[model samples]
Target: MKGRKFSPQKKDRRKAIRSIVEGIVLLTILIVIIRALLPSRGYFPVSEDRNLQTEQGFIAVSYFGVDRTGNKTLISTKRLEEHLKALTASGYVTISQQDIINYYTAGRPLPKKALFLIFEDGRRDTGIFAQKIMEKYNMKATILTYAQNLTLEDSKFLKAKDLKELEKSTFWEFGTNGYRLSYINVFDRHDNFLNQLNTYKFQLVSGYLDRNYNHYLMDYIRDASGIPMETYSQMQERIGWDYNSIEDIYKRELGKVPDMYILMHSNTGQFGSNDKVSAENFKWMQKLFQMNFNREGDSLNTSQASIYDLTRMQPQSYWYTNHLLMRIQDDTGEEVAFVTGDEDRNNSWDTLKGQPEFIKDTIALTSLPGESGLIKLKKNITDSNIEVSVELDGNKAGIQTIYVRADDELEEYLALSIENNVLYVYEKHKGGEKKTIFSLNLELHDGIKPQSLEENKLEAEIKELETELKYVSDVELTKRLNEQLKEKKARRAASVIEGAKEYIPEIGISEAGKRFLKVMLENDEISVIIDNKAVTERLKVSVTEGKGVYLEAAPSKEGYSQRNLTDDVYDGVFKSLVISRYSTEKKDDILYDNRLAGFEKVADTIQKGWDSLINWFIKYL
Candidate 1:
């Protein structure tokens, strides 16, 4: 039987079905392949819950003590003893800086109450005193020193020897405050910035390596010669000594670290050559610490009891010498507490007392032990009642209080809450008396409640990706490579022109020929155009400008000679003929000629002509 002719529509439908089937098969295979390659959902198990409990407490004693002259200093022996007595009496545990650093770095919890003692400037007296007191109290202190002062003779300053001794002690560690105290001044100068930087490096390395090694060793010791002898030094050099830089430097030096850091600053007594506390310098220091500790103000409270408690990790929360108002709300999002700095002693609380609606409904506490100044309020409501909310007028700087009561009987229903913000008091009545006796809202403030590394292989993968991205996206780098290519081409063009220049004079050429040749030889822009353009009818010549040379070329109307001209004229001809005397030094012909050898001799000559023509074209183009 003869095969039946299929209709066009039927054929098209069959083809479409085939395509769809093939697409479906391909898609299915792709899906399977993707599923096989994709990471499994359960590949990584949940990490064990990290202990996020933050024990909030103040550093009881000031990290730096004030001296007799009102200058900040390390705690004197007498003061240290008194502070320690108070700290211990308050049941606080004193830990060293090393302990803190180690515990924090290891991700271990700190003691309930802990304080860190940090001495700046590396004074001999402070160093000696710190060592003795730390030894006595079994505590730790960090000493920040200017490396330049670490000479052997300057025993009055904590020298290299003292650092060595301190390093051996479990209670102390050393940090750099710069090579000299001149980091600030030197950094500010514009003209000698680079020189001062070099000096800083020399000083830093010299302080570290100078005593042990002589000039010979210093010159050859690559690591020991620069201002950036240490990783921290290099970081500081790059990023400067801003607060972020300091924190980053600390981490680089100490490894994975916590928020606490030992910093140095000038004391009042030892204000160096500068007479007054440099507000700028102090601001820098304050910013640095505030950023690191996440504290609010510069006024550091130095209560020995609080310090001991903070150091030991006791009393989970305590106020900083400076306080901040935080917003508080009940489950229902009602405004219950609103405190302002100005209202701490009067005003806001008194206003609440005068409000008849609040006063009649709330009980005024006359003689509630430890609850006198605070106002108390209470009311009977269902389980779904809105909780109190506390709002602050401004950033609250100090503490405030609140009190709540349930019944009319003064003794029956009483709840007290203290906060800088509004306090939500949840209460339940005991018996069926159902007498709404005492209900008072108290404006009071008390603080309470302690509320709560890296895999190298994974890191390597991330770093590799970053490097690849850098290579792909760097425009400047690509431009630089292109520039190098251009330079090489220019040198090659120059070589061909030099050789052709000698031949041109022998060929009985005209004065115009020499002039054209000279101008091409000098212009860089002429050289680039000569190398880039193609020879064609009308000899569509494009010229640009560079160096001091100008290009002028007369086009030959005769096609045959023009063809011959085309063979001799490439980019090199214009590049070599133009005489550019723009550079201070004379152009080196021999070097250019040698590079031109890389290209065909004929092509090279043509390039020079093209270069010259382009130079002239540029003047007109």
Candidate 2:
């Protein structure tokens, strides 16, 4: 064997080749590792861990009881007590009605574990047994009673004596389930239902007031207090009744003294039944209560001892349809001052024939009927007198007064005052010995602004027109436009194909064909045309590109079948086709380049048609 030695250049080349091969292998491994570690497209990772706290928080349980026949009842005394105990054991706190009202009205936070124990069809069992349990546990519950059911015969149902006894306990509260429990469809007519409800409220509240008055009189007599029997007689006489009027009853019973009011309703009714209490109904009631109490920001606190206590402690009232109205109170048990239906302008005064006069000192003011209607009060006085004024609207009503008195009497006599819509002196005082005495002037306005009927009609018309336009359809017109656009695009594509042939022969056949093919392959618009049935039948060529060289067969005048080639081989064949078609003229090269450029413009035109069609379909179809 002859000994041979390799040159240094050859050895260096060999080393370089080895290094390139190693680099390729390392890069491939790195890519594989990255793909494994990172998330891949269309794949999502989920954790299976179960120890995490997934629930946001617990909502207060709203509880009810049912009888054997599936009718909701409040008759079982023992069972009610057991229910309270169960609720407490579940980490729930018992609260007063006032607390619930206050929490919602003041936008305060509520406990996570709170419950509302509402008893329906106020049975005597509920007042006796449930009251004891509630008191022992310091629990608060609202009992809905059928007013008609409160008779001496049905001891199972709450009677006047039973309700009075319950009230005395401070554990259970009362509300009207309805005047009658069954048979009468009061709620079937909204107006009739409301009227009946108002009647019930007056009867219940008035009864309570009367009993308290009687008790006070009895105590006075027993103690031999100086208060006379005439005073007691006058108080009794004041207790007049007008089932049709809440305002009259309120004036007679309360005498300007603020008190708690709880309205009631039957949880189970004939039409829908208690089982009709779906989740949706519960949500609706929740929102309705919030709105009624003007509780805009937070959940209600249902953990209070009684709805009345909850309401008295808080500065707001809570009302539930077919449930109970909860009034919160203070620690001293003094009822808080509040205006109910009157605040919402849904009081008896709304339908009265004449305005209610509110008089302060020598000045008198009255609110007129009609929405946004103004009621004014004016008084004329001599010079040096001060004037007073007041305004009332659906949202708010207030009064202001002014009076001139001696400098020394300013603090004693000329005090600013406000009471509902009446404004007067804070205290009575004799004028000082100042030589001049000035007269008083006063004026009042009810702030009611009547809306224009014409404006309202026009607004309604505009809304209706807008709704019609929202649903208008133009699908057929859109389809026609899309078809027309497609045809125009096809014609434009044909023009570009015809012009490109002139430049095909300029470059060498292989190079020119390769350039043409590359332009067509890269351009979506041109590629679509080449793939078209008509174009494929008109021109055929075998093209290939390899080792940086392009080759293509010459185009024959006679049509030939289309031939497919790999990318590398096709690049060579396309170059050859371009040279054969365009010749060596510079103009031909320009034409070929320009024709290929037109493909993009054609695609843009087609895309516009697509977008217009899609948008039109979305908007008006």
Candidate 3:
């Protein structure tokens, strides 16, 4: 049987359907491309009306544990509860790292009084004692523990099972103190070769186990033939392995990764580093980790050696009431517990060493000097009115007014005043009740001191002069000059490297290339000229299209020396500049510059997406 022919109308209808389907497909593809190009919205929510100025700063407190009976390494459970109770009564709200970051970076408002609570080294009792107490008060806290300890089946440290259970809780977040928790010899313990091997072996076996791992450890052992000592690269490899291994184990066991890092022994003068090589190694590792968390390294081009300078969570140990009295300056300052009181004499266990059921309130006056009464002594001075000024230690955020009083009475000769970092307190014999007892309380301001019109103008002039002086100072100018010299060297080096790799003929080239080639190859100290422009001063340099090229100078009136490459060199098309090599040598500044340029490109590309996302959220969300 012959099939019936399709009608013209039916054929037209089918064509229309096909066309519509094609149009839909094309439209979907276009939309997807547009979405990909446009940034994703910010994951963090922000407030429309953010008042960073008025928002209270965060106070972070670090606790070891609640040691009932002061057994191993902890305060009594009673003392712990009391401290928590006092903090809660003080109208302070405990916050998370995310909360703090949100307030600082995303303009999210924080509570009027904020605090960060942390427990370190992963004691299992933390879950039993501190966790219950914190939950009772509806507080959140972060726990930091090492990966090595978690792997061990022990009651002393929090085990993998406990961590997994704790991770399920809403009030707690766990982070890494560091893996290995190994004590590094900060001094030259290498004088005894056996001690060095033992330390190395201990660290090696803690996380990774291999019979041949000892052989790898021996690679770092001392040598007599004067092979250059242990280098930072070796240390970086070890540190990297340790961190990666622990993180992997945690991810596998707990199914979660921690974002916070706390320094275990920051005050101990060494953080798992032995000598110079290890120190640098630790610096690099820490920087890498910090950059990973904060994502600031890419933007700031932070030096690895300056990892300590990065904004990180600082530990403040509060063992007593005086320890809680931190003098806050403003929105940006450290929470430091003054180590004034003798913990040996004032700790909860000091009085109740044997009694586990003693009333916590009996030892409530552990840190307040006023409760015990002032110790009587000869004025410690001959003057009737002994006026002395004490300086605030390490509080640099803003101007603060400190109020000092003895008991509840204001002494006739005793007065408190603060001038910047200086704290002035005076005591007189003509006082109503002469007492040496003192307590410090702070009144915080916006940190901006209002100035009169004349004062403002004078100050502005002084700042301007200072700025000018700074630019022209010997050190500043030398830095600028050195940068210019380095740029020249780098550009010269890149040209040499590229020419060498490509085997670009040495005979025929532009006059500029000839000059560059001569200085690089012959080691002649001839000033380089590029594109008929005499580079007597600073000039921008880059490699593009597989060839070295020059860009315009920065928008500055200051003339260039050899060529001072400013930050702008990596902006726009300049970021596309190709860099082939970098080195660990001091003389390889050129290589360093090249690597930095390359890194800038990669970081910028990654950050672009984030920026787009933030902008999208700001606009749409």
lDDT (Cα atoms) of all candidates against the true structure: 0.31, 0.29, 0.39
**Clash totals for all candidate models:** 91, 70, 7
- Which segments of candidate 3 are over 4 A away from where they belong? 1-56, 104-107, 186-229, 267-318, 326-621
Q: Would you list the rank order by TM-score, best first?
A: 3, 1, 2
Tens digits of per-residue lDDT, candidate 3, 1-621, equal 999997999999999999999888657655644553332331222233443333345556666665433432476555576667766666656767676555544666566556667787788766656665676567888787877777776667887777766756666778776665543321111121112223334433222121221122113433444343556576557656766776687787677656666543332234432455346435545543431221110111112223232223321222333324322211234332322232322322222110111121111112121111121111122211111111222112112221121222222323332222222333333234433322222211223333333333333333333333333558877676666545543432222223322211111000010111000101111122222333322211111111111111111122121111111110000111111122123222221011123665678677666555544543353
Best by lDDT: 3
Q: Write the per-residue lDDT of candidate 1 for residues 155-270, one digit (tens) a residue.
A: 55776666666656556666545434322222111111211223334343221121122121011112323332335334333323434544554445444222333222222222
What's the TM for model 3?
0.39
Kindly provide the TM-score of model 2 when superposed on the true structure, using C-alpha atoms: 0.24
User: Candidate 2 on 159-258: residue-level lDDT in tens?
Assistant: 6666655655565555443334211111110111211112333333221121112111111121123234334334233221111122332234323211
Worst 10 residues of 3 by lDDT: 509-518
TM-score of each: 0.26, 0.24, 0.39
RMSD in order of candidates = 41.8, 38.7, 36.3
